[model samples]
Each structure stands twice: as C-alpha cells, then as structure tokens.
Target: MDHRGGQVEGGTPDGESLPALLRSWRRRTNPRGIPGLATPGRRAEGLTQRDVARLTGVSERWYGALERGIEAEYSADFLDRLSSALQLSPAERRALYLKAVGRLPTLVLPPEAGMPEDVDEGLLQRFLDNQVPAPAFATDLAWNVIGHNEPLLEWFPWVTRQENQMRWVFLEPEAHEQLVNWEQDWARPFLGQLRYERARHPKNEALMRLERDILASSPAAREMWNRREVVEHSHGALRRLRLQCRRGQEVAVRIVALRPMRSDLLRVIVLMEDQRECGGA
Candidate 1:
C-alpha cells in the first residue's frame, strides 16, 4: 500500500534499494552496541570487526571484508555467528544476509511521487477531531511522537517528552512496567514497524540513532532485535492498556490506530473503553 512516499510498482514499493537499506543498518549498529567481549584499545561502544570475529570464532580480516560489502563465501554458520555478534534483530539479520548476497526487495514510488507536509498535518488533525471519544496521536515515519490530542497525551506523558516511540517501548522502565504484556502488546509490533521503515529508508540517520539508543538502554530490545522478525503495522489491531488515572481509579483502554491518507504516519491512535472485557478496577 503506497505507504511512505513510495509507490508499489511491479509488486514492490518504489525507491526500494538494497544498498540504501544496508547503509541504514550500518549506521544503526555501532561498534559498542553489539553484545560480546571487549578489550583494551577499543575506541567505541559498538562492536568492532574484531569483536564480531571473536564472537563468531572467525578471523578479523574475514569479518572486515564482510562489513566492507565485498563478495565472499559465507556459510550458514558464519551468517548465524555474524548475526549474533552484530546483535541484529531477526529482520535486520535477514536483510543483511539478503543484501550481502545481492538479494533484496525493489522499492517503487507511487505515481503521485510524494506526500506533502500539509497533507500529513491535515489528516492527523482530522483523525484526532473525529475520534474524540478515543485517545489519538500522530507519529512521524520514524515513530517519533509528533502530535496527539489531549486524551492520549494525558495517558502517555512520555509523548510530551518527544521521545521516539520505539525507545519508550523498550528502554523506559515505566513504560515496560505499565504495558500489560510488554512483549506481545508492544515490542513485537514496534520492532516490526521499525523493520518496515528500515526496509524503506535504510539510510535515515535519525532512525539509526533511535535503534542504537534502544539497544544500549534495554537488553530486552537487544534480544528481540536478534530475532529478526519482519512485520508491518496492521490497521485495526487492538490492545488493552491498564493505567492508573487521575481520578484514582485504574482504567482499561483499547488502543487503535488511524493511518493517514497518503503517508506512513499513523495520524491517530484511539484509546477507548472495552465494555465487554473487565480488568481495571
């Protein structure tokens, strides 16, 4: 579906380029972020080529060659080790493997070309106004909370902090504690959305930093990243959120999303009462 200023030509989105995707991944996975042993003279927090080699029990020269995007023979064992050493989420690991072997999806931009800023703002406002009974907000392509109505902002104070959604989902302790089922309710889908974005715009520097921060802050996010699951945000998906409200009562709400007309931005996320389900007191 023409999400993100790109078209779906020949069964794929326009501007779907593999090199771009690889560059994006590289930007995100810094030397210190990967989990493994470290020694003196290491200048960065992200894993170095040597570190990856150590973790995978391979030579540093070979790993360096791989990182340079040079053509080389790689076994499944080598790929698995590299994936682990890099702490690549399942989606990331797969994308790396595909790109390394010259197998990646082709992106196609829509015939209309691109989405305008005004259109994004208009659609977001419309959704917030129309879905008054529910809490709603619009997030940018990078999952940064860009705008939201009063109700949503009230419940999620972090939204006001301008924190990236993925960071809050995985790094923030409060967020983790408040979410009903952190893994199923948030992490899984959140990572999926990140994967989709990465696939589309792999070279986005902001996106890369967000991923790095999440990895450094939360081991849970790191573990999940290694899983490499590719997922797209599904419309109409609902999740129950239990929050301690201002009225001193625990409230249970269902979260739903309203996507914009021509952008990847999720214009609004409505949180409403679940009359049939009982959890909050």
Candidate 2:
C-alpha cells in the first residue's frame, strides 16, 4: 500500500477491495434516516458519495477517489469516520479496515463482545435460579449484578442490595471482613480484572466512573489501582471467604465464570463448595 496516499499497492488477500465495499455500503444506506438530508426528488437508492463525504468531514473529491480505488494513503481515523458515515455494522467495519489499512482497528470491540442492550432479564434470572444448591449470580461487562439466586444471597447477603460487584469489593467495609486474604486474593485480582475491563472497553463510561468512585472512596483500592495488575477473569480459582449463612466459619469455593452463547457480555458466575475444605458445605 502507498503509505502517503493510503492506497492499496497489492490486492487484499480476501478477494475484496475497499472501493467495492464502500460503494456497496453507500448504496444500501437510506438517506431518509440521516438527519439534515434533503430527500425530495431523489432518484438514487442510497446515499451519494458526496453526501457520505460531507457526513464524514471529507471533500467529495477525496471520497470519490476512494470509491474509484485511486491509490492514496488513508489514515485509520479517516477510514473509521467513513465507516460510521456509511453506517457500517461491526463486521462491515472490520472488513473496511482489513480491506483498506490491512489490519483491524485496535480499540472498538465487536458488539457481540459485550452484553446486548435488549437482553432478557427474566431469562438471566431464571438461569441463575436454576443453579439451586450452588451459589450463582449474573454480572454485566462492568461487573454489575444483574441477576442472582437465593444461594448466592446466602453466601453474600450483600449481593441482595449491591448493584455492582466491583464496587462492593472495593468500597464496602464488609468486604474486608468477609473476604479471606482480602488484599492479596480478593482485592488485588478483582482490581486487576476491573483494569482489564477498562482497557478492553474504553468507550464504556460506567467502568471509568466506577473506577474513579472506588479509588476515591477506598484507600485499599487506590493502593491496588497503582500496582497496575491485570487479570481477565477469576474463573476456576479456589477462594476462601466468610459466608453470611455460616457466620464465623470460613468456606472455600471454586469460582466458575461463563458467558452465555447468545450474549457474550453477560457473565454467569457460580461458586461451588470445595468439597475437601468445607465437607460439601
């Protein structure tokens, strides 16, 4: 590819080109949905190249060259803007980057990577309810507690009232008392997990706000936040904590984290008793 003009020097390996994709996408876009567009007496089906260029903050000539597959250097930002102006889906956007820049955009996670906004709360609740004897709860991308079973509340009664698992872990005084090895096992890894999520989904404002609140409210969280530890998930880890139902006795459990096939953003976490440590609880 010509670095200066951002043109493709060689054909894309997938047998697709940027110009074809751009034309196809632009042709499929409806002008009526776009605000500020004059739709009367229009013979064309989709948006014109000039209209897309205007929306994308580029000159019509430049956009026309792109459509003509003229050899020119293109910046990732410009391509991203073009993708947005054309209303490309996540997959289509990826294809745009791959066809144009020879790589995928670094920051934007696919829509399927997180919980869908229209997820069925009742279904999630039922899924948790089915866990029965095992303590189970559901959390979103930001670790917000969306669903829980009675067994989970038995283990951590605070889950009944808490909205976010991360907030409760970092800010609540009860967390320190109930979590065994609070600093090393619970707080550190959990904070690292939060950091990982923040990096993975930088566009998520809630994660940023949650981090700021925890850092401001808890000295422990502030201290751990600086350590820059990173963990994706605590799945399969054996952890010991004081269960509300068991009172003074410390119970050991294995953590199981799962993402629903239908919605990757929603997490279903189940905690099973460590048979040897708790004697089947």
Question: Compared with the true structure, what per-residue lDDT tens digits does model 1 show for residues 175-276?
Answer: 766677779767977887777777776876556777778778888888888888877764565565556455434455666656656655333566776666
Identify the runs in model 2 with alpha carbons over 4 angstroms from their true place: 1-115, 279-281
lDDT for each residue of candidate 2 in 9-109, tens digit (9 for 90 to 100): 33654565666677789999888878877568875589998899889889999989887666656787788788767876555766777666666665333
Error of 1 at 180 (Å): 0.5
- Each candidate's TM vs. the true structure? 0.53, 0.58
The residue-level lDDT of candidate 1 at 259 comes to 67
lDDT of 2 at 55: 94
Model 2 accuracy (lDDT, Cα): 0.77
**What ranges in model 1 sit over 4 Å off?**
1-116, 120-123, 246-253, 265-267, 279-281
The CA lDDT at 6 in model 1 is: 22
lDDT scores in order: 0.59, 0.77
**How far off is residue 116 in model 1, in Å?**
4.8
Candidate 1 — worst ten consecutive residues by lDDT sum?
105-114
> Against the true structure, whose TM-score is highest?
2
